[model samples]
Target: MDERTRADVERAEAALVEHYPRLVRLTYLVLPPSTGRHRRVLTAHGLVQRALPRARLRRPDGGLPAQRGPAAEPGYDVVRLRALRLALAYEGRPLWGPAALPQVWGLRLFPRVGGAEELALDQALSAVPAPVRAALGLWHLEGLDEDAARSVLARAGVEEPDAAQRAAAQLDRETETGAAALLNSAEFDPCTVQTRPTDLLRRRQRVRAALALVAVLAVGGAAAGLLSGDGDRTGRPPTTAEQALDPGRLLRTPNEAWTDTSRVDFTAWPVRGRQAGDRELLGRALRVWAAPPADARIMTSAGTSTRPPDHPPQLLYAGQIDAVTVVVFYDGERLVRYAEPEGATPTLHFARVDDADLTSGAALVIGRGNGWMRYLLAPWVSDVGVRDLLAPAGPVHGLHVTPDAVTDRIPVPPEGGTGCGHWPAAQFRPSTRIAGTGVNPPFLLTDLNDLVPVHLTSVPPGGAPAARAGEATGTPALQGWARTACSLGTLRGAGVRSVDNWAFAGQRLPEDSGSATWVCSRADTWRGPGSVTLHFLPPTTRPAEPGRIAGRARDTAACSSFGAPVVGNVHWRAQSGKWYLLAAGSHGVGGIDATGGVRVSGHTNTLAAPAGRNAPDEVVGRLRSGGTVRALRP
Candidate 1:
């Protein structure tokens, strides 16, 4: 194994070759047209990347943490936007926050946003289908290649790969026409893109950026353990900005993201769990939804807010990160969800508290079909695997209705399906890294939110404290509770692991895939998200074999001015904020994960940014065995 160089390209290529399959997948959201064979393939490519979550790139001295922007220090806003895009792309659907797609796409559609409970959509061209929104986002905002764009579409649907290829061509032609309108629209300009009023993306980015970071920081101890635990200060700020955008925030009371009292029929829904109302949850869900999913402190005060009775009320429930049971009862003590948050126990307080009246676990929720249905969104009432990504809905784990309605756990069908149609790419896994390694076709995966499946089962039921229950010897031993699904055993300890591999596993410190030792302990939900701190030992072995090609290069559409020098074989995600230019075969730096997902070598990059103010846009320089990296422009 050897090292990788650290520098960006003189310019990036816009062609399919230039864009990494993962990046193409993200951009395909903006791809003008996604019916081509190219789009289909790109969709497939993206799906793979999402599942794999790794993007191979050259490292100069060592690897740099992935950034949001293309400069030594990227604009905070930019990184926030990119992260949101990634989250939304989890299920191949464009999960919108506060920000709108680039002005051009918005221009194509008319505005459908209204006051309170108002959603931001385009009426310009009927409502842009979820697919079109994703395409437009990738193409217009992310700027992916033609053929690459098609790859992403393939994941969504496009049984015929050949047709997907043709659609990419048509999409490009449509893009050119929209480009002119975009430049004239408010979005093309930086000022408007950043500061303009009336625009949602820019505004949402402000709030969403901050909130996103907060949520990430708020969740359970494992979340806290892995995220902002050690004072391993890179001197970098905790977050560039708050995730100011929360599309649901614009709703009347900020809790409008949920339907007041709608019947979410799970008789046929997958991974059953009733939604916790906005008000009933008190403000807990709002805060949690805005913040990260784990490492949250269940504070009585946090869920104690009140609301009017007739006013739209929100509901909430208590459960594990994997599954949260929804119970809407109105007893004397459980007036506001907050008061009863501590219903049976203390840790199990109001998942959300509000100023409303509530009662027993058995409550009535009126609806059209069932007229009156008992709403108990319990977690994993029936244990269903949540990994199937491409399905419209996964299997219904538990279908326990009263004997009269539907009861008993749905038997785990022996033949892998529930008579539900096959999901286009249920098993597709996309790499988290966007620009690195050879360009694979795009593919869609499950929604990031979907990853938060309502898993049920008695893993220390009653949300009991793990330490006291003695249920801490399993794969994920926790003092109180362990982060769901993710156990060091599965990816690190002898269970199909990798070393220094961010390509598949998450971007943890050191990122060692095999024999990767990380500390997972319960942390305080209130003070710090948790006490779990995952530490990857500096690799003693190199990650990749010598001469193993990595990194990326593309035309200008993805990077700079139109027709800029074709930046080829450049590095991928060297730095977060800055983009720089470097020549290939400079010198290998940092580390790489050896094949078979086991072994690691090299170190993180330590090169200086080439571009003066915002250099290092592209890190992961393509260096040789023993070469030194030099500035291309300088």
Candidate 2:
């Protein structure tokens, strides 16, 4: 009505008309996808058209502050604020009402179909809450920084705008082309859309079906009420135990069956626990496995399924260890372990060992507490010993076991430390039948945060045959492992099935320095590609120190049974106080070359050249076939 107010209204109207398409696109991106595409297009346009008056009449005390930077124009900022607020308010509410404006009839309008990337972006946006989508659109499509987006979100009535901004940034990082490119694609453009006719025949058929189903349900409800007796009528689903089979029906193997069976896997293990026959405790374990309680702690290895077994599972053990009740079950595909303390909630763990062999299925950690772990050995394990991997010549100590085949608590090995103190590993010798030979050698196994322990073995330095489980006990193999054992800490919680250390290359230093050995340690995991690490062991003078890491890679086939060549380089300081560049490769490599800071080449699998400290260089290995392979970096 007043002159000043009239001029402000005109300016706001002009801004709305000039930026109509951009505002509609922003609202369309921020609007929840649950509003079917046809309705969304019309709603976005209607909201922007109505934003001009709301901006002009906004209350001074509650209105949004003017936007900063390029969007700081008096009219554009107010109009954008009003439009964004209106779009956000549409979430979780009906898209259209009887008196709602801009309604379309007998037609469906939706954006054009896009490529796979656009479809993936659309689905990702739909998975998040509406406020997060708003932040993404403002920060990406509108080109606003994170701080500016947060301010806009706060003024538009989001309770936790900072959290939304963080979520948007994470989502952007996950996408291949970023959210900005996908939001700008034609797949989300409302102005460029395809049209289709409404399906009247399907609508009529759905109405009739709904009416008939309602009438049938009404009649069925009356008949059920007449047959029901008076009792607690609260309608709640059955509990987890009530839905599963009774504990009495669980499958159990005979105590002596393992002796005669040819299979050496978990199926041969007999029930050997003090509480093996407790039906009440078994029932509680079954319920927790079926549907864990809210307070229950759960852990699973990579690619393991959490679904409960469909049939009755076989019980392997149910016992008390360290004042805690532990239960073990095998469902043919998974090995499930459940532990419950006296006054604390239970913990459920699942691991996938469908392809486990005799060496891998020999032991499982049954209990762990106070920096110690107890293992349940196979029924055929006749002897158990603990060995310190860091001390090759240290005597092996005998480990005591109970009649149930569970060993006494053994100190857990140190994950990593400033010094190579000690690393404990379990050694097991099987019975004559399981060993299949007159002479039985002990197998070495170590826990790596999984249900089944990983087997540790080694290949001798001079290309001796690949060592079996027991062959790693030789003097040469043990000495090599003493220097390589500390590096195994990196494989913790990696789902590794086994690790083999190969003393592949040994090279004499260039300037009268002592010989150094190159050990390629490859960890084979249960899922995905295995990890490979090249370790550089200095001369014998530094026996107290662990091998220095030279190079590493993930998902590489080098140094495995397939015989792929691997190359690595390191900067070494000799006893003469001079630095040199040292490089080595596996057997198949015909030549090794180094470029950049130092230039050197060798026809054999090893090469060394004088260089400066921290000198940058690239190393490559050439095969007999003339193909080049890059070295794995540290």
Candidate 3:
């Protein structure tokens, strides 16, 4: 969580200047040479011209650190590095995978600049593709592991590039004797440079002086410590000895044993589900609850370590399920935490951790019924560690858990069939204890039975208007035609097909029974295992007519489906409810495809941003403020 100051960079520069010749030689190996004939863009003349000298450095101290190295050099051009990575990637060269690149480089030269060279290399990585270079540098240079690197590579989309024949040819030419010629060899150490005789002699003099001075200081410091009878703390301060430095240790670690998971596969992750019954909702919406595949891996993140890509992991995590969102959690590239809502109040999560679980960092707090489901998104992913990925606009989380953070498992008071084997909600004891500070966490109760169960009396076939469940009033019915065009991005959600517009209907009188209607599609709906639907309706409800939007805003479905026989129906029924006609307009069933066609999308992760489930093409309201209109069929 600590930030390196500009002064730290200056110190690195001085080190570079003091060791320019070797550094240049190292850089030269990476570079194709400055020969005029160089067309591979080893000629970084233009890019280096703009970038290098412009490079600036700062030290840990607020004041300036001595500068003479690349940090201080006017031009800290890294076009060569960028060019190198691009060439390797574009040409599909058999260089190290992105995650292990830096560490692999370290194998060639053990770094000893006391973090200076390493820091510079880390910075240089940004000049290239962030994911690839960072992953590679972390694996090759720093001491990350295979599990850590796998996470980085997945984020970078970099994999084992060369095949067997290519790899064999490359190995023959690179195996010790014929190594340096490979484009990605350690010969490219930017720090290694050609040196002049005079410069070499001066370098030797400086090195000798620096080493001699260090010896004198060490001996003097030892004598002083011995004479004073001072205690030694090894690398740590005495006051902090026995102090736990592993940030991960303090976290409420995942009961890895409790979670059932598997390796990540392109297709086998999503479980089979139903195409009939209440399976229909919206034109297309991602099945909210997904049972990860038994074969999916845990998405091993070795922080760019030695783990090879082909080696499958033991669990498929939320990130692997949804790549982009997961990267937001695994990458440590951000610093702040936010608690934006699916439909909750906004706040911030503030915490700075050097090494810790994502939950250990500041977590944006949120609340829903039953104290269940607190979704958080952290910013600055994967810089310090995988925990840095999720940064969103949420509340500022202090050091302790909030009331909303503690959720109780809802008890199964018998509306049920085949309950879970473990802690069944029916056995859970109710506690008068309030949630949060000093109180035991809330317990699950047959809480729903107390609230009026919404009733669904069919309206038969009628020409009426549609509104939020339990709040329909007189309005123009859906007219001629209303069709939203689906593009390649339309079905991009995880197994999402179309939007579902299902809710309870309110009659003119309060005493009348509430009815339900459904608007959905069956584009990508599948029938499989452990499928669940979560209604993440954050109460964005403004004052409706006289009071509040009284409809229950809770996700209410989680069961096995056997509806594939009715896939043609496109409409699914609800358990706590069923469908009837308010005023059916031009609502129909359809799906979008790739190339802006229909039914051409390959999978869900590739679905484009915001697939229009919550989007509204038009509005209908009373003749005045126009502020009270409800969003109709998504």
Candidate 4:
């Protein structure tokens, strides 16, 4: 053999050995999932193992070219392209020969089961066409850009490579997850798989009775066909009830139902949009919900189901919100919003609100575009206003609303930054009857990139009674929120239903220093588990200076009513240049204790002990009710 051919062979061999597991994983992700887990595992290993050059280096042909860009290692790229092509070919048609090498018998092999997020992503990827799946695998698993993905697809013999890439991109946008993150999960990793013994006894019995079972099945099939007489010629079952497509059958409440209905939830929201009676619009929306088109973008909040409603849904509102045609529907369990922009693909969003209440169901973000958002208020809403959470004393600007209850566009807050200059929150007052008093208490709602906005409430310091939503508008409450509103960005897309900021403790600093306050913010999501964060707001005159995040915990109920009291500590240096450890807890916390590098205890909910900068310790709060609550980890 020529020296060049020998070198090519050696390079290919080296690459195959070094990146075997990664290449196998890539092929497994690219292959169609219909092959089942056992066969997919074996096939992926077989394809990747045979990816190296055979004996000689033939001229690079029209086959998949070496990938460029980030994964531009010549040898690795060559083998990856070969393995990818083989997987795609296998997806087009079943392998004709005997089972590939690395086969196992009498055992079922499959990857470990992943969490809900991974399962959802797997199902989504499996729904797309094989070529599109390959494109996604390239873009995410291989970390390639659109251009690079298109090039790889074209070289791999995809007829419409650009279309495949576009479809993959559309799916990525709809799923709202980084494909790489899901692909790296154990659900797709075939190398480390779980094994289960096959039903060997059942298999043997099946083998013996195969012919007899087939004969009986053939006779039964003939009898059933003769009796059925052309059942469902379309070959696809109906996704929704018969009346779901009939727009006239949609349930609608009267415009003034809220005044008399005992139920104060969305059940009383009157259908009051300009296009509420547009059958064509309503029919299209229902059809998309039943079976979304290939090009439509669909989004579902975590834990929200994507199934169509079993019965005709209630029509809450159907009208133009901003520049898009919007349709809102409510089944008993889920809230679905459909938005279509002019000359653009439509989007369908679903959020679970089965537990929505008077305060949580007050407002919904109906439209968002070009850095602005619009809200659809409930029938009980009497007035709408906008407040800048950052400027506690700023005037609450009045927002104009159409006759149909759709508010004008309000600018969205910037996503993330240290300098939270402005954060806009919607403030609306419910009818006095709904409030059950002479005063129409105003409620606060902020858009967190979900169909329903999150309710914002606050509690004053010094164990004062927890106030209603209106009291959160007070200067002290607003200032406290201003110091922590930016932190709310972390809760975006987390299916959060409401957030409560409780200023649970106030402590005097040693050496005549100014006081400090400890606020525990708990975000409760629609799905059960929520998050808790503790903030340390030092005495500051500048409102823009945000507080420090002292501690945080996930899936915790601390700081919420009836939950464990939250405790946290931070080492602070007073203006006098002396450092000390300060700890505090929620109301009912009988005492505080610090362990590890520093040991200290207090008879009250607050504790102060001198310590150095590097003092490491764990703090626990002892409840007056004979229980202990640990501080959240930083």
Candidate 3 weakest lDDT stretch, 10 residues = 476-485
Candidate 2 residue-wise lDDT, 18-99, digit = tens: 9888888888887888767667888888888877753335434366543333432477777788889988988888778631
Model 4 lDDT, residue 146, Cα? 88
Q: Considering TM-score, which of the candidate structures 3 and 4 is the better prediction for this target?
A: 4
Candidate whose lDDT is highest: 4
Q: TM-score rank, highest first?
A: 4, 2, 3, 1
Evaluation by lDDT, superior candidate among 1 and 2: 2
Poorest stretch of ten by lDDT in candidate 2: 223-232
Q: Which stretches of candidate 2 lie over 4 Å from their true place?
A: 1-244, 435-438, 462-470, 542-544
Estimate the Cα RMSD of every predicted model relative to the unseen true structure.
28.6, 12.8, 24.3, 13.3
Question: lDDT tens string, model 1, 462-493?
Answer: 22222232222222222111122122111110
TM-scores for all candidates: the values are 0.18, 0.66, 0.21, 0.67
Clashes of each: 187, 0, 131, 0
Which of 2 and 4 is ahead in lDDT? 4
lDDT score for residue 149 of model 1: 49
How far residue 235's Cα lies from its native spot in candidate 1, in Å, is: 40
Q: Compared to the true structure, candidate 2 yields what TM-score?
A: 0.66
Q: Assess candidate 2 and give its lDDT.
A: 0.76
lDDT of each: 0.26, 0.76, 0.23, 0.78
